[model samples]
Target: MAVLPGAEPFRHEGGEVGVLLCHGFTGSPQSLRPWADRLAAQGLTVSLPLLPGHGTRWEDMNLTGWPDWYAEVDRELRALGERCSRVFVAGLSMGGALALRLAARHGDAVAGVVVVNPANKVHGAAAHALPVIRHLVPSTKGIASDIALPDATELGYDRVPLHAAYSLRVFLRMVDGELPQVTQPLLLLRSPQDHVVPPADAARVLARVSSTDVTEILLEQSYHVATLDHDADRIFTESLAFIGRLAPHAGKEGTATVG
Candidate 1:
């Protein structure tokens, strides 16, 4: 399938500390391009990969599943590990669940994790019917571009593929089961008024994760896609600060300052 023009994957080579960013389901790398660029500017090697079923038409996503998406990010993570001394994973929504899965599977190899509006479980009674709905219908409304900023927009599919969404629920369930195994330091940024991912999703992760160092920051002015909303600066600055505190030696060589 031909990829979208602005949805291409982004890669930047910098120091030994690498940051792998994962965009949400149905969203392309465009969603996290700015964030990846900011991290790269700080002399940190950064990669924002477009998942297997994403960055193309919505119909393409229907042909893919969770494992396919996970495989792409896992490949990037392994590649980053080979060149970078330390590596961290940051994701949005479904990407966050993938990050947790990596932490659970890799342990200390993942230096830390950052998630914004992470979704671990689906809500509403309709979620219970995903299995049937996926077979009956091909798609429904999309959950993209849920930003509080009026003019702000996110590059994602206009329709939600039921088969792919069902796969996401299965993936989330798997990640939830492995949450207790995630012991790496975690930074979670949440928006209280997020319409796409409910606050309960974040609570479920916080309660299950075994991480000793967990920081939860509330983004008052943003929505589900907080990375592109009003509090985007906070997410970027706080993420840099989190990386600095955890990988102090990694940032010493770079001129980037968190302010």
Candidate 2:
């Protein structure tokens, strides 16, 4: 993968376990930065890569597709595998889809997965009907509208590329078929009040995934952006514990080996 001119390299703390943290669609690494910092403090190397066309202008997202996003994630996951004894993945929203896809394709390499408000389906018929609007309307770059993100105090580009959304739907279909292939321990953090992805979808994920070692934690107060909401701390704590358990050094390390 050719390094983008301004993108941050995959971040790694000095440790044996590797983690890749992916942010939501059209969002920056800024969303996951706090969680990444906390994980690094616990001595696990973490990578937070900007997906294709994200962290820049929203118009850029129109040019890129879901495959591009997955390709970038795959590159970072491979890089983490090269450096650490064990690798894990965590993602929010669109990133969650990427994480699951990674686990499906590289199950042997990923030790565990933490998914926060994964977007497996678009909630309603309005979204389904407006599928063609993205093609009709020109993407308004960096348009911040409050309606697009009601729970989130921060707003993102108001306009979405319809074709991009359509592409994302196709990616979801692919991952749905690939779900049973992933067998790693899963920590699903979902929000009941999530305006983006419904609770039913989370249930569907838990049901479909073949992993026997799956735990679902419901977030009552937060919406889709759980990373920055009331349950954010819970996400941090549980995710750390989850990663800590699968860590290569967890029970194997002697007291003197602690870092």
Candidate 3:
């Protein structure tokens, strides 16, 4: 399949530390390309993979579900671990849920985690209907480009595949329960006025996670897609600092690294 214009996966080889960046559901690596580039500029190897069934059409995404999406990032993390002495996983929204899962499943292999407007639990009345509605309705309006900036746009499907969304809900439930197993350092960035994910989702993560080092930042000017919004630089800068703090010696001069 031909990938969309800005939706290609991104990879950068830098120092001995690696950072895995994951895009949200229905969103391509385009959403995190700037983030990936910024980290690469800091001399950190980065991997921003386009999730399975994403970076293409909505109907195509409807055929694949959360397992396929999670598998893509999971594989990327293992590859990074083999090359870099230390690795950190981060993402936006559903991608954040996936990052948490990685930290949970991989344990000490993941040095830290950074999540922006992560969705850990599905809520609202409409969400409850997802299980049944997906069978009747193939898709609905998209939930992308929720930026506070007037002209900012996130590269994602115009429609939200109901089947994929239902699977996301199920996937989040599993992540929520697995939160207690995530013991790595965590950095959570949240948008106060996010329309898609409520404040409660971020709260739940803080309450459930076992990480002793947890930091939360409020993006007052951005919305759900904070990565492409007004506070984008803030997310990028803070995340780099988080990684540096966790892996201080990994980026020193003469450190060896692999692809």
Which consecutive 10 residues in model 1 have the weakest lDDT in total?
250-259
lDDT of 2 by residue, 1-259 (tens): 3333334434755577878998777665766766877777667777898778765556677788899999999999998899878888999887898999999999799999999988786545645654676667754333221122346443244566656776777788788888888799999999888667777777878888999989889887777777877778899999988877777473232122212
- Among the numbered candidates, top TM-score falls to 1
Candidate 3 per-residue C-alpha lDDT over 1-259 given as tens digits, one digit per residue, 9 for 90 to 100: 7999989899888888999998998999989888888887778888999999999899999999889999999999999999899999999999999999999999989999999999987776778999899999999889888888998999998899999999998999999989999999999999999998999999999999999999999999999999999999999989988888888854554223432
User: Which residue pairs of candidate 2 clash?
Assistant: 134-162
TM-score winner between 1 and 3, please give it: 1
Clashing pairs in 1: none
Using all chains and alpha carbons, the TM-scores for the candidates as numbered come to 0.96, 0.86, 0.96
- Global lDDT of each candidate: 0.92, 0.75, 0.91
* CA displacement after TM-score superposition, residue 16 of candidate 3 (Å): 0.7
lDDT of 2 at 39: 77
lDDT per residue for candidate 1 within 29-143, as digits (tens), equals 8888889878988888888999988988999999999999999899999999999899999999999999999999998789999999999987667788999989999998888
With candidate 2 superimposed using the best TM-score fit, by how many Å does residue 10's alpha carbon deviate from the native? 5.7
